[model samples]
Target: MNPRRKKRLLFATVLIGGVAAVASLLLFALNSNLDLFYTPTEVVQGRNDGGAKPDVGQRIRVGGMVVEGSVERDPTSLKIAFQVADTGPAITVLYDGMLPDLFREGQGIVAQGTLVEPGVLEASEVLAKHDENYMPPEVAEAMGKEHKKMEYSEGQSGY
Candidate 1:
């Protein structure tokens, strides 16, 4: 190969490698920054386990059943508060935006926001459960024991 051609090829290879490295770094950073939410049972038992609670301003997503009657919307503002449950305790979620169409009482929901305090989620994104049987995998696992208990109870009742 010509010397000049070899140099050009080397430079092109370096440029491509640098671009790839930058892309990988950006992807890693983004993934680390993104956070997900979980139900009360999940929080108690630690489904998204091992990581410390996010800093006050970091984003997160929380999923659970909306407590039976805990939804309260502001009369004039977009602020809304509700409790997310999973057979154990409930986490209070405060959101300040228009809610999804499927958000309703006694239904499943996933709210994305920041954890302003322990057991309190300040949500910026409120995602209602969209499908008939779509429960987050983490939420399902957290509720597994409770579901089994219900099954046992039903068997005993014979209905």
Candidate 2:
């Protein structure tokens, strides 16, 4: 009611508003840049993150085992396509770059890119497991294992 009290209240309100605005901007920036990880089943069945599926044009990361015998490559170009599978189902990933040396059928890998379809991903980067004893934690978890090392015999397919 008093002038001095009124001025103090106004200053407090302004300061709180500025802080809230800055916080909102920071959250938006982080959310926009976030690339959520998903599995083949999650992609097809719809992810349950906050009860919303990933947008068709949203960028994401898919981690799983490279489906055995699912790799197809163009002879004249760097384009390649492969199926990645978890315990539930498989999703196709298309990439246009040199693959890592460790990349192969039954190998665990993570592809980062945009989801152009419900079951297809247009990958911009593909990362393979670095060593025989290591697999990505996300991939392992999706496959029902917790930090399990990858080991496959001949004629075995990645799950």
User: 44-107, model 1: which lDDT tens digit per residue?
Assistant: 4555547554555656777778998899989999899999987877889998888988889888
- Segments of candidate 2 deviating more than 4 angstroms: 47-52, 145-159
Give the C-alpha miss distance for residue 131 in model 1, angstroms: 5.2
Worst window of 10 by summed lDDT in candidate 2? 141-150
TM values, all candidates: 0.68, 0.83
What's the lDDT for residue 70 in model 1?
A: 96
Clashing residue pairs in candidate 2 are none
Model 1 spans with C-alpha error above 4 angstroms: 1-20, 42-51, 148-159
- Distance from true position, residue 71, model 1, in Å? 1.5
- TM-score of model 1 (CA atoms): 0.68
Q: Give one digit per residue, the lDDT tens place, for model 2 in 1-159.
A: 999999999999999999999999999999999999998888887765554667799999999989899999999999999999887779999999999999999988999999998889999999999998788988777667543556898999997
Note the Cα lDDT for every prediction shown: 0.78, 0.90
Q: How many backbone clashes can be found in candidate 1?
A: 2
